[model samples]
Target chain A: MNGNESVAYNLDTEEPGAEELRAGFTALRDRLRQPAGEFVRAKEFLIEKALLVCGMVSILAIALIFVFLFKEGLVALQNASVTDFIYNTSIQYEYDPVADETVAVGESTAYNWQPVGEEPKLSILPLLWGSLSIAFLAAVFSTLIGVAIGIYLSEIARPKIRETVKPALELLVGIPTVVVGFFMLAVIALPLKSFTNWLGLGTIYVDSYNAFIGALGVSLVIIPVIASLVDDALKAVPADLRAASLALGSTRWQMIRRVVLPAGVSGVFAAVVLGFGRALGETMIVLMCAGNAPQMEWNPFLSVRTMTSTIAAEMGAAQQDGIHVQALFLVGALLVTITFTLNVIVEVIVNHYRKKIRL
Target chain B: MSAASRKSLQAVREAVQKGDRAPLWAAIFENIVRGFTIAVVLMLVFILGTIVWEGVPQISWDFLTKAPTDGMREGGIFPAIFGTIFVVLFMILLALPLGIFGAVYMVEYVRNGPMARVIRAAVNNLAGVPSIVFGLFGLGFFILFIGRNLDYYAFGTPRDNAEAQLIEEQLEPLRAQYREEAIAQAKIDELKGKERGDFIRGYVAERMPAQNRKVFGQGAMFWAAATLAILVLPVIIVSTEEALRAVPASMREAAYGLGASKWQVISTVVLPQARSGIMTGAILAVARGAGELAPILFVGVTFFMPSLPLTEPVNFGPLVIQVVNPFQEFMHLNYHIYTMATQHPDPVGTRSIQFGTTLVLIVITFMMNIGAIVLRRRYARS
Candidate 1:
């Protein structure tokens, strides 16, 4: 018989070909099993890679934002020198009837931010001053109260009270910045102005919308942020430090002041810096309550325009591709740089202290 | 020598007695700090109390349902309420998946790699970027760039002349009326020459009907929602990461021991356990999104919109509502409050309405936050 027929005959007769058939069947099964294992491995690899890409989106977004802000803002810098734009303070935009245009009238050939004047001034100094003053005020007020609240929550408050009060304080953070601005404007500003008037400080003239009210509103927003951060920082101080101080015959306040505060000093600093970053970037409170008058005055009762307020107020009406729009973008870029640097610094401090504690 | 030793001993005894007398200075300092802490709490209570007291009077069934009348000095803020809800809902939908996926990747896939550190830094920086900056980004990227591109693709390359003509024709009567009013007012005020002309032009331009015009790369609801989604993304990611981290390690180990794949383990074991925390993160995102006004200022918010963002009732069927084109501008509660409080022609006259709008916004945001807090507590317990 031929080889194939002999094998079939052997299989039917239970001869040597039966062993060959069994070996072939076993080889086929192994081939199938190998691919199954490979499929599972392939899937695992694919999913892991996909998730990694997803995780990288935040990085991608940050990069994209930096690129876009610089690209748009650089257009303004090309039109006006950075030194002129940042250093010049005057915002006088005089209309020249002869030329049928608005022109910058001041003798100084420096940039000023008079977006609506015939000659638009793009100076950023007043905006910077306004932002800094209000943010400074907010930071000062919030830090004092926030640290106290943090201490209270971490050390003084009973456990049940802490649980209730901490979340309730956090709820304050959820209140919209606009609502805070509204509260400042409708509920707080009038009374403040009246009170100032009643005190016979009429010359001080707390404009319904002024730096003080703006700072007040902004402080409300920052308090919860600062409090939460400081609380976490204080909590992070090892319990042993407080216990040791207590064991040495110190009261709770003394223990906190001597041991916990020292240990968590870096964290508290980080909290303040982060709060400052928030205040610097805050827009709506300053927009609605800061009064959109770009001025360099430090008086808290006077109306001042912050960088964020200027951007929000003027961006809507600024002509697309015009110097005005580009200038607003430049302001945004400046904000990004400042806030970003502050964030990095705070992060570094926090990380360093955390590592130190771990060690 | 004996007299000097006795005098020193008497002085030490007086010092000890002073220390035993209640530590008055320490007590005073503690009370002062406590007073400041209580003041912070009082400030919150006072703000909420003021809003409720002033706003409760203005909140009525009709006020809640009707559109603003008399230059936004009176009537209900239905459009603003609807727009706020619509924008927040849209934001949550867009942000949740991206945020959850990002958090999962950070927590599950890349545990402690260099890439993870960089991503974390990026997120932290993003969180620090002000809401106003987000608005500018939205205005520049979403509207000027993306919206323009969309318009060019959807409608041909150039402006549609027919649509422009239709809008101008619709604006014709309104413009004429503004001109007449400006002339009459100018006459009474004895205004002269250029001043009168300027007044008429400004009035007509400011009062022109917005919907009649084609969506020519202006602010719109879709862009606003997109901007808000970006604004709250960091919040969602951080909270979601925290939630995922809270899931016990042993749960994952048990699944792995059963030969379950990594994906299976995460989906079945880890995700189920972390679901409530993720939900809490989502709710917080919504709360934050709902309260935000600055991000949408340049992106899409209108001072007043008579109709809802998505649809309006039309006599087409029993439940007849015509779908609002998504590109149209819309009002928002926070923006409405802003305009009423600050930008209204008669800001002093619109006080009740502003308080009412603020109250509604606070209630909505606080409800979401309280819900999230409750969810977190439940999760903590379990």
Candidate 2:
């Protein structure tokens, strides 16, 4: 309070205000010694490096796949012309004048993908369509069955029954897709063929089985996914909400339909999306059961080939850098694009629902 | 008023009682749908059962230990068993660390930023790619790289093979015009082979004659393992990421609060807790790796070989070679059971073996899955 009194801080000492200087230096040391700062810095650095390396590895793997496909596919692509490839001409009406009954000879087409042509006619449109059709069919059937099972497990069933049934259903997941294919090929395909023939629909082309068998087989694989995800999502809906709904005098079915189902709709959608993705990517069942014929027809009882089947079937013999190989890679790219788009859409929907519906 | 209320309740109960016993039509419909569901489930079980029944009766102790012979009666699955183990072990050796590290980085360290986002996107995309694509990749990338790197051993002189010889013959005329013609011709020849011998020797050295080891068998265990690794990586990464994500945030917070480093938190707290989940994922992955046929058929499954099963204590290769070719009955009890069961040969005699193999495969997968499930449940409860 006097001009003679000088304000002094320990950071700058003339004669050294000993206590103040010691306190300031100690404070500085403590700041440097905070464990939190060191931990954050190290953690951030390691994570950054790890993520970069992982990112590089993933990109490298995916890029390698692309390069290989393109390398092989390019060889196949060069072997055929675009026009012949797309139109896929088959010599159906051959000039057999000697027989007098106009016997048909081999045509430019049989099913959809006849890539093993002398001139190489690669019509993938039918196979793509068949792939989508079969996948869609499987998704629909599985979703319906799975939703019902989900409801029973989460809401309707007794605890004992739920426990018993849940594992049995999940056990289906352990069964290999190839085994499933063989099962359908032997049991479902043959039986369905006979049934169709007996039903006066013998002309329905069930002679060798078809996409329906493949779809059914795929449904078997995906149903478990739907059931599991739907069950989780439904269970995730707080029990209090269900109690509230029932307290409002709603019947069990009414409460489930009005409140629980809506609450878990997004999750159910995710399950279906995942199921669709599975159906789309499934190779073994479709390869075995769909007759491996890429037909563009809407007939479920007709033979069909999918993009996956085509790739699997022809990749073995497709000449290096040939036109056929290129088409196969193109198919891979197409599949990747379709699944990626579907995943994005599902994620968007999921994020949206999570934001919109707090419960 | 109480009487009226009681009467109303009684009326409601009577309606409920009536409703509990569904109308015949409704009952029929319910039964029909349930019947269909049961039928579908039964169909699945029957398929598995049939494969086991058919496949198991044919597998004997001798069949497992002996090398494959002329037909189903003569040979065993010793080679296939060895091949399976060799390929799987090598693949695990290669893929596990890579996939786990990648997953760890993705979940543990990576900030929720663009770089992490890109990595996540790559993983998501990788999971969707077909398994066979990996086979092709393995063929082109791994095989070729290995071959190019080891070309000296692949070719005896590193330049004196049919391809190289042909290239030299073509360049002989060019050598006369230039002083460096002979050297240029040799260089041209070397370029023509393009490490062909190196690649071939790496895979074909075991099978090829030492004097001429130019051509390599396309199918090899390394190729198989690499391809399988690619196929299973996506599954492993996805499951690992999910498992890592499931770890309680408080676990990490507590460790950090105790002045432990981030690595310590992950290694001690996060990893230990997520171990069971990771194991479950790996088990499923191995199951997937074992079941795949399409990729390996082209990449590694041998059509024929005439060497004894590589089962002796000294033969250290990952695959066992069958002294007899496998193509004849490929449907034998142990090896190629899946392939044989469904192939054109549909002989009545081989059905039992098919069933047995199916049973074996199913049992193995089921045991692993059950263990995983039980462990997961215990972890959850704890």
The candidate that achieves the highest lDDT relative to the unseen native structure: 1
- Per-residue CA lDDT of model 1 for B301-342, tens digit only, reads 898765666655588566676775567788889988888888
lDDT of 2 at A332: 69
- Candidate 2: residue B321 Cα off by (Å): 16
Clashing pairs in 1: A102-A118, A102-A119, A103-A119, A112-A121, A112-A122, A112-A123, A113-A121, A113-A123
**Candidate 1 local lDDT, A329-348, one digit each (tens):** 99999999999999999989
**TM-score for the A chain of candidate 2:** 0.75
> Highest TM-score: which candidate?
1
Judged by DockQ cut-offs, the docking class of candidate 2 is acceptable
Candidate 1 — which residues are off by over 4 angstroms? Answer: A1-46, A87-112, A203-205, B1-22, B158-216, B311-324
TM per candidate: 0.83, 0.75
Candidate 2 TM-score, true structure as reference: 0.75
Evaluate residue A135 in candidate 2 and report its C-alpha lDDT on the 0 to 100 scale: 93
Residue-by-residue lDDT tens digits, candidate 2, B334-358: 2355455445355345545445455
lDDT of 1: 0.83
